[model samples]
Target: MRVLELLEEIEEIVDTAAGFPLTGKIMVDSQELLEIVREIRAELPDEIQQAQWIKNERERIIAEARTQYEAVIEDAQKQADALVENNDITVKAKLRADELMRVTENTAKQLKIGTYDYLDSILYSFQGKMEHLSSIYFGEMFTSIEKAFDDINSALAANRDELKDMAYRTQMDADDIPAPSAESEEEDQ
Candidate 1:
């Protein structure tokens, strides 16, 4: 489902929730919200994949650039070899070949730099959205932790090991976040 649909689902839940007497809080249906959150998680990977495809395309373009560069070099060699019998013709052929090689190399470099810049911009845009998502996701996790703290003192005394296990699992889940690159680490700071 689209993101707007997910937002709409959340809105619907909030709108239909049972209100508290004095607190400005509503009792939400956990199972329904969990299902929608899962759906949102499922959709998130698709967006990530779309961004990943730009990286893939950049590699492809680099490959094609290399191929064209090689082809140019081969053609230049063949032309120079065919005119080897005449010194002047051979000289001209070699000069033309060198010029073509230089031009192709410069073109390839520009293409690669441009591709990298384009991919970087795209990833940065996605990063902002992903950060927002992480904030929301962990915000929910923090709320759960707060609630668990509220009533779990006696229960925790009884099942301390179970609480430890739950905290461990939550930590593991949170640690599943992708690590940033050196540049992104700087950006984050």
Candidate 2:
């Protein structure tokens, strides 16, 4: 009876020893899982920080580009204002030139009219005197000469009877006509 009991106890001890290797394997697997979790925890914060840095750089670049664009727009507006000012100045100069030309033309026209008026006054003042002088020099002399010519033509055109009548009328005339001569009367006696 004691030998049987000792054999049974030795068999139980051998079974427990075989199960120790499985427990050791399980502990090793648990330690490997813990190490993997530690590595993930170590690397995650660095990746997140890098992502945040990239986002901040992109925002900064966008702000800088916007500032440059606004500056360019402001410069263009200034140039346009300068152009408008120059145009206004040019237009004013042109209008002034036109006004000056008009004034000059009007002055010239007035001067011409004044000169013509002066000339007309001189001519009108002298016209009547010139015509009167011409008429006095040649008027009554031309009429007397024409009458003498007409008398000579009538005497030449008379017949003998008309001449005898004219001589008898001359012998009888006193104050209304003039006698030829007293010597001619004695010769007739």
Candidate 3:
């Protein structure tokens, strides 16, 4: 979230920058840009940590569900064993134990299903946020930065070419100036 806000600030800076007349180039504060970029780098670890937390929480929930399932199964088995030990109502006890087992199994299945659905929803939401951030914010920011660098490189190359041309002309002009003869040098002496 802080990263998103920082990205928006960068966008605002670019949008508000003053452009060179007819050049399609804008001047930005390099210091501000660098500072915001540093902040973004700093915030990235926090985002990663949040993702790690989500994964840990999901695992914890799953473990809890498994523990509950085991506890329910154990309880159902103990009850069935106790019922079977009674020799007077063996038939009724066996039937009751079978019904209890079916109900317990169904409840365990539902609990597992519910746990999976909850984890899936959480993961789905996280995935959406990641997609939105990458596609909308990072994508546009990278494009703009790339274009700016390309413009800067073009301008620098043109300036270097102009300097080379000026240097060549200066050399040609020096060559054109005639050197004084020996007689002219003697007269000056």
Candidate 4:
């Protein structure tokens, strides 16, 4: 499941917990909470792996660009060789070949520059997306985790206060109860 969906589910779980009377306390099942946490842990690695895959894809694109550049250079060289076959029109052939070579070299240089620019833009886009994804997801996760911990802490503090209140009430009620006097105890004996 998506991280956002998991976060929503956890929020729902917390929202659905039974609230304690007159306190910021909610009762949550430990097993259910643990299972969701386990799923989140499982999802994190897959997200990281996806980032790795994008890096690999960038490298693959660069390699393909290099291959195309080499092929263009090679094809241009072959055409130049084909144009230089005869001694009859050697001067004309040499001029045409040189022109073709210059054009081919310029085109090759342009193609290389264009390829690098395109790849750089794509990689920059991917990097931006990765940065945004990490910031958003990690920020969400940290916010959720921090909220959950805060809620738990509030619940614990409330529980402690309730226990103290109960203990005090019990002690007061015991104090109010009548006890037999020493003379009554002696007469009874």
**Candidate 4 structure, TM-score to reference:** 0.59
How well does candidate 3 score on lDDT at residue 92? 76
Per-residue CA lDDT of candidate 2, range 1-189, in tens? 232233333333323432223223111132433444355456456645655665565555556555654555455445445555577855665565455555545654554455456545644544554355336523433343344345445545665668899888877775566556899889999
For model 1, the local distance difference test gives: 0.73
Best by TM-score: 3
- Candidate 1 lDDT over 1-189, as tens digits, reads 375478567767667777656644466666777787787777777877887797798788778878877887788788778988899988887888788788878877887788788878878887887788668754655465355344345444657888888999999998998777899989889
| Cand. 4 Cα-lDDT | 0.74
Q: What would the TM-scores of all predictions be?
A: 0.64, 0.32, 0.87, 0.59
Off by over 4 Å in 2: 1-86, 151-189
Alpha-carbon local distance difference test for all models:
0.73, 0.49, 0.85, 0.74
Please write out the lDDT profile of model 4 over residues 1-189, one tens digit for every residue. Answer: 476677677778778888767766577776776787788788878767866886787677667766866776677667667766776566676677678667766866786677678767866886897688768765765665676677888878978999999999999999999998999999999
Prediction 3 TM-score vs. true: 0.87
Off by over 4 Å in 1: 129-189
Each candidate structure's count of clashing pairs: 0, 0, 0, 0
